[model samples]
Target chain A: MVKLKGAISGLGKMGLSHAAIVGAHPEVDIVSVCDTSTLVLDAFKRFTKVKTYTDYQKMIDNESLDFVVIATPTRIHYEMVRYALEKGIHTFCEKPFSLTIREGEDLVTLANQKKLVNQVGYHNHFIGTFRDLKRLLDTDVLGDLVHFTGEAYGPVVIKEKSGTWRSDPKEGGGCLFDYASHVINLIQEIIGRPTKANGSQLKRIYSKEVDDAVYSILTLESGLSGVLSVNWSDETYRKMSTSLTILGKKGKIICNASEMKIYLKEANSKENLGKGWTIKYITDFAIPVNFYLRGEEYSAQIANFVDCIIRKSQTEINSFKQALITDKVIELLIADSKN
Target chain B: MKMDKVLFGDNQFFAVNHLSDEKSREQAIRFKDDAAIIRVLDQAREIGISTFMCTTHDRIANVCDYVRANPEKYRGFKIYPCMPYAHKYANAVTDLGIIGTIKQYIPGNIFSTFTKGGVAFIRKDFIGFMELFIDAEMKMFKGINTPVIFIQNVLVDLILGLKMFDVFKEYDSYIRKKYNAEPGYITMNLPALLDSLNSIGIENPIICSSINKIGFRMSGGINIYEKYLTEKTFRPIALQVLAAGALRPKEAIEYIGKFPKIESVLFGASSKSHIQETKELIEQYL
Candidate 1:
């Protein structure tokens, strides 16, 4: 099989991480890199032998790239993804597929029309524990899902940090867009689209422009309810930690980055050990991978994108259409918060 | 008449669920009997809460019935009725069409009601339509003392977002003139609503909004809400003080107690112990 050639835009933390993953993957070739800073460009110079460009459009026009990884800030995602899709390149944009729903819908339509493999960087979906939980859900082990509660807390913006675009509302700042997007994507993937959403967002300790904390109550189309509470400024959490508890008629499943516990009233399947509760750690289910930032999820997500391109198929996980639902949900929640 | 600093909320009694579907279902089943609701209210009264800030839900009509039946027991009981109980209108629209809904709620002589309804539709007089809806909502609490009539946050924020200040003026005037009640506004964004009411010359108006330590539902963030709580002229009633169960009882009441101008702390509890505990905590903290 031939390798897919790709280039990465933006040299931020996630951008550099994606570039490294792409450089290491056997089925992918890194053709070029794009960033405005010469310093960021210089850091990647010794590691990978590839041409670098400051302007994203120039790189898209100059390189014969098969696909481009858009890891830029949220404000520029619409324009970058549009240009990439219009150029008929399979695109992998970062989370928050677009700032606005209209832009996100247009990009999804363009990608589908062009028949390109489109994916978003919602890496949490590819995590082993979540993947296992999704598998468990498919088997109906937990019975009919009734309610879900998720919390994503971290110490990202505890103080008034100036310099970064993450603190600016126009740049798609706030835990709602940055952190809670992951929770939204995960919940939507696990439970399905909610019919109604009532939410609140607050800028507790961070800049006044963006929210450091967000809470939402979502009612699903299937009559199930879900709650999301995310605080990016909470000092109690060491790093970014996300936990989801899914309650069903027969049982419940609690999952986080480290472990997953399933409690059942009566075991139906033969594989079940008993009827009570079973706990599994990340070490039990996680597949060993070559690269790690948060986990193998990052590499797994990128690999899925490459496999879709190779197989000429649409991405099943974190597709542009799927991520569009998350974007729409965020918009609704923001509107509800203001009310 | 003065209201209680710790006001009992009717959300739990009406099964207005915010967090869990199962909890909501349980509450709906438990409170299916209005006697149970009255029992909780009686507990609240016994715990020394004189005011109940409640929505005009269909079940609340029964609560009013219970309150009015025993006037001797509930002699000092007052209700701050939050109006337009959006679900009622939504359920009405689902059951009856737009015109049928208006006909059902418009209170007056049939000829005047029809004339007013026609004029409202013809001239697109939203304020006139708003006044009719307010009157319809206030129908249940007619004989009871409703010292403070609130424009629900749903309509308040909708009007604020649409920049319909004239409707706010009309509601304020109608509630005061018709019921002799002080008009209050409930909103998610308190600071913004205060500014909107101030622009309309509604000075020191009563506003009920979400105010908590974690800033759970506070729209413009906690610090700005704190500033408004300190310096704003309005009588702010702090609701969602527990941040929807994020804060402990003591921490929740203590957080609100620190806010100088918060005229009241509104909370909901289904059990007697919870009600008594919450009242005791508020008294201990504040």
Candidate 2:
């Protein structure tokens, strides 16, 4: 059992989280790290023996790596991931894969051509309740999905404040990317890709540039319709909250990160679901992992990346193709908001 | 150590619900003003629960100001200020950029340390910067009785994952020497954190974690936690004991009450009846 060598390119919040997750893997050794923050890199240099670099190319060119987790800003994900793919290293880019659809598609094509084990960091796909929902949707628990309402809200940008990358639309800031990408990706995978979005609204409550909230009505490829509602300016929530509610002729299902609630008109014998309502905890469906962090889903996503790289195979869960669809949906929603 | 049998927490005032979002909003609406928060704190104090374990939110700063102003009225009240409110730094970093965040959050004395800093600062900046932030977070709780200072689970679990066991030692020494308070750790993974702290030779560590019947957010599961509770010597505090309102109060209290080694049980509620009932239950069961 040979170990794989890994490197991480960013040292932002998500980057540091991935470093902790990737650094703890039993089958991997973190050989190098790259970030613009001297303070963060200094901490890493002082704490661990991983080689630190200010330049992304210097880290990639200097180290012999098996994979790289690119957790940089959304504006630079294209260049960072493309360089990693071209270097023949497995790449795991963070969520909202790229700033634009063209950049996402180009990276997708390049990763495919290079035959790399590419994945994106949409950790929601690895959540226990969501995984169960995907499986249950394939079953008859919800007969012929009629509609859905996807929502995410957090107190991210409440007060009128100066701008960061989050408030800058060109830098991939906004509710659509920072907050709602998770919901859009979940809607794409669990339900169907939103083919058309209309009457969309990107409201700016605080920020000068990017939207603080996003809302729209969506029609899926299968012609199933739904509504998307997300807000980051709501000060009521303690943290980011994302949930999904789907309706069918037979019953309905509502789910979030912690638990799931389902209602049925009649019992489904094969799935062991009874009539009326059933409440299921995430622990029942959560898959155990070697390492634990903020949540099981985070470590599970990183472990999936390492496993896919070890097997030299691409992952369907949080894969680059799946993320490209999310990028596409973001563009559609933004275009609709203008109308 | 004058540990209270039943402690009142401030999670509800800050809209921190472990499971449900709707409940958090309800609490936010209920505790909308500083007067509302002080009202609950005063209620809990009158109900004989004196200690308030809360985060260093801006609103908590206002609460601290009120309590400091009216000392004789609210006599013998204590607060356990949790350092490094992650959201404070997160929102500051977003608005002010990295360097501005440092200048804004770190006390003026930190720059003096930086000016005197040499290669030693480079080597020890990670832990040293943490102390600086600790100093900043402590500004709001001045002239208040804080018996225990806690590091939130976000940093504790991050350290556990990084396997940076040495950071705990630095924090332990700093909190004890500078603040004259016992250092406490709050984590989701109690077993792993206990292992890390024990390996660092911090004996009889105080840990706050989820101990529930349904194992909601209990990282290593209920069995491992039970093994530690009955077998281990560390001081334990149970939170989310009701499993985010999932378990019946009697069943939850009775299950935890079976473990006599649990030193304290922390709960947050808005109503006086709920607090009185819970405090009674703790006395009755434990």
TM-score for chain B in model 1: 0.92
Q: TM-score of model 1, chain A?
A: 0.95
lDDT of 1 by residue, A29-73 (tens): 888999875655643453236788998999999998899999888
State every prediction's TM-score relative to the real structure.
0.54, 0.90
Q: For residues A245-312, could you state the per-residue lDDT of candidate 2 as single tens digits?
A: 99999999999987789999999888888999988876576666656667788888988888988888
Residue A147, candidate 2: Cα error in Å is 2.6
Fnat, model by model in order, equals 0.00, 0.31
After TM-score superposition, what is the CA distance of residue A214 in candidate 1 from its true location, in Å?
0.5
**Model 2: lDDT of residue A198:** 89
Global lDDT of model 2: 0.85
lDDT of 2 by residue, B63-142 (tens): 99999999997688889887667777665655555665676666565565677753346346677777777888898998
Q: What is the TM-score of chain A alone in each candidate?
A: 0.95, 0.98
Lowest lDDT block of 10, candidate 1 chain A = A286-295
Quality class of the docking in candidate 2, CAPRI style: acceptable
